[model samples]
Target chain A: MMVACAVLPAAARSAAGPTNPFLRLPMVTIATHRLVLRPFRRSDAKEFTRLAGDWSVASMTSDIPHPLSEGQARGWLKPGRREVRFAIELEGRLIGGAGYYQRRSGTAELGFWLGREWWGRGYATEATRAVVHYGIEVKRLPGFTSSHFVDNNASAGVLRKLGFEPTGRGRIICTARGYEVEAVTYWLPARYAVQAQPVMARAASAGRWRAWLSRLAGRPA
Target chain B: MIDAIRTDRLVLRPVHPDDAEAIRAQIADWDVMRWLSQPPWPYTLQDAVDFIGSCSPDDLTTTAFAITHAGAVIGVIDMRINPALLPLRGPGPHLGFWLGRAHWGNGYTTEAARGLLASAFAAGVGDTVYSGAFADNAASLRVQEKLGFVRNTETLVFARPRGREFPHVNTKLVKSAFRTA
Candidate 1:
């Protein structure tokens, strides 16, 4: 499942070339106090398919399709894709995904989805804060813009807790529902992002070392 | 392909590269821009070129024309799909336009937009069209009113260039209503 933040910077965006620094940044792992938000690996496909295939999860997102299969999940997680996607891990298990997508120059949108079992656990909030924080602190983005289907108050609550203010109303086509849905738009400037608590400052580490260090550092198994 | 549609005093046709200069010149005026949602303040030539470059004559998503008078490019008019943002019964395109500051009061905007709407319907874009203007943009509202656009709702909408929200009037025009009214 996906939620998006799209903000095009006037000076940096051009028809021919994008000067936005975030557009050039590679997707990397970000960590929060309760979650490990890392870019998806091919092996995570099975778990991704399992969680994202649920209709309730798929309907809330803009792009996730219903009845998603492992093969489809793998294709979407392919390396070298423009948008950055993360596998949200808890207790070393892939429970959900979150990431930032640069739809055009100067602006990037944030999206995330957790397995139905993980609902109401605040995992989405943690993972989204990690990604949004990374984009602002590391990628130098000014802020993020997000939208939620009006009926999806749970998602709205996550944004509200993250300091995103409702700006207006818009619509986006939900691929799962096969129709456009009314959505409320929200914006969070980088300054507000600083106020989001528990933004754990974890460095990017790769491979077995990351898992070993995560375990050694007294985090969840 | 976007073909030229003629009115009594203006020719509406697909915007061209050469129109970039005129677009930049006309839209740079604060008086011309304060109401527009996208184009940044201090509009530039590259912005005009980019806009013109993105227009596809064969693409149904947008139909943009350089509003010309006696062969001189003065402004632009376009009808673009709302992409299902409103509560309309079926698909409907949004009407957007801007006339060069020098050309504002001659009824040219209404004339050009009317011709473009006709062309859009002929091309099967949509039967109904939706439009919006900043509540303070009385001239824009008057233009819509002149074309029989029925005021539907007023809502707060973000104008990106201005970086703030403003009350905006959402209006709709149906072919049948236009034909009778």
Candidate 2:
């Protein structure tokens, strides 16, 4: 459906901006069956430092350093204009972190790190899927890119479940490891959710519904 | 800003945790799930709870309502900032809705849209509203037609439930053209 802006006379319209409307929005707390992926809050700083500080967890991520410091953890949580970061929580307890950082090329890069103790339970996959879906369904991002050190087999399995396809191999420094390591890059188009079909099912039809809502005992939605 | 709407046959209200079971019952149906762009297939109670939890009075980006008849939720409707429109223009409300298959053909959908659209326009957020349905969802398209929504664009929409794209027709309604009744 046409938007209100189009109804205005040319002289009244704002300076033409980029036409594509799909861009990062204010970070929103995304929820899935097993997780609550939310913007990091100050109260979480201590737990974040502890989990990300673990040697097993820090070693897997590219930027997080060993002995993750309160100062460094605070730096990661700083509100950013170009990226959306979420602190992954399970049952009100902090576990890992997942979110995307946008590139000037107009695509977001998805990244995540889970506590060593929380590994093997599929929380990484579950948390990352929420981020990906939020990128596609809510943010309208065109695609996402991610990489894992080739040696991190557990991480590779998680990416596979999210349908991230191999793009190439490259070297990225693992700060926790104190050196560069071989990594495999992967890409997943936002379109993957709406892949090739005879017709675009349910895409772009946000107006396919009508109805007003009444308060449900002061509930949301 | 709109918190509640009352149509002759329906009370469009905020979704409640109590509505969780009913929302799951209808949305899990392939008949409804197939038409929605979001909401994964094999719908779970957790998904329903998540959706309800996501709704908030303060969130200007999305406003959702449960379409209730006789105090029972039979459907859901929402208007939210169309992310695609946020750049070129501003936050334009995108309207969408779905009902249990059993509730179809009762004119309830149209009634709900009228109440919500009128309230939205009255809020002075925007003068026009955008909406559309899957090409094959003629019933949904017809509902838009009744509200004075004219076809504006056509494109493929990715749906999570089907895990594949399907053709969709997008439409829009201006305040002046809406059918208030």
* Candidate 2 local distance difference test against the native: 0.70
Q: Compared with the true structure, what per-residue lDDT tens digits does model 2 show for residues A1-221?
A: 00000011122222212333322223355445456566788878899898888877777777776877898888867756666777777767888888776665545778888877788998888778767766655455557788888778887888778788889988877788888878888888655533422243335522211100112134343
DockQ of each: 0.01, 0.04
Runs off by more than 4 Å, candidate 2 = A1-27, A136-140, A189-221, B1-181
lDDT of 1 by residue, B1-181 (tens): 7569898899988887888998998889888887887676567799988989878776545658889998899899888764324332125678889999999899999998888777667777766888878767889989898888977655334454554333467778888776422
Query: How does chain A of candidate 2 score by TM-score against the true chain A?
Result: 0.76
Query: What is every candidate's alpha-carbon RMSD to the true fold?
Result: 18.8, 14.5
Interface alpha-carbon RMSD, every candidate: 18.9, 11.1
The CAPRI-style docking tier of model 2 reads incorrect
**What's the distance in Å from true for residue B95, model 1?**
1.0
The superposed Cα distance between candidate 1 and the true structure at residue B78, in angstroms, equals: 0.5
**Poorly placed runs, candidate 1 (over 4 Å):** A1-221, B59-61, B82-90, B179-181
| Candidate 1 residue-wise lDDT, A1-221, digit = tens | 23533323323242222223322323344435456566678888888888888988888888777878788888867633346677777757888888766545434567777888998888888778767766665455556778888778788888888798899998888878888898888888655665553322222212223443454588853
Clashing pairs in 1: A5-A109, A5-A110
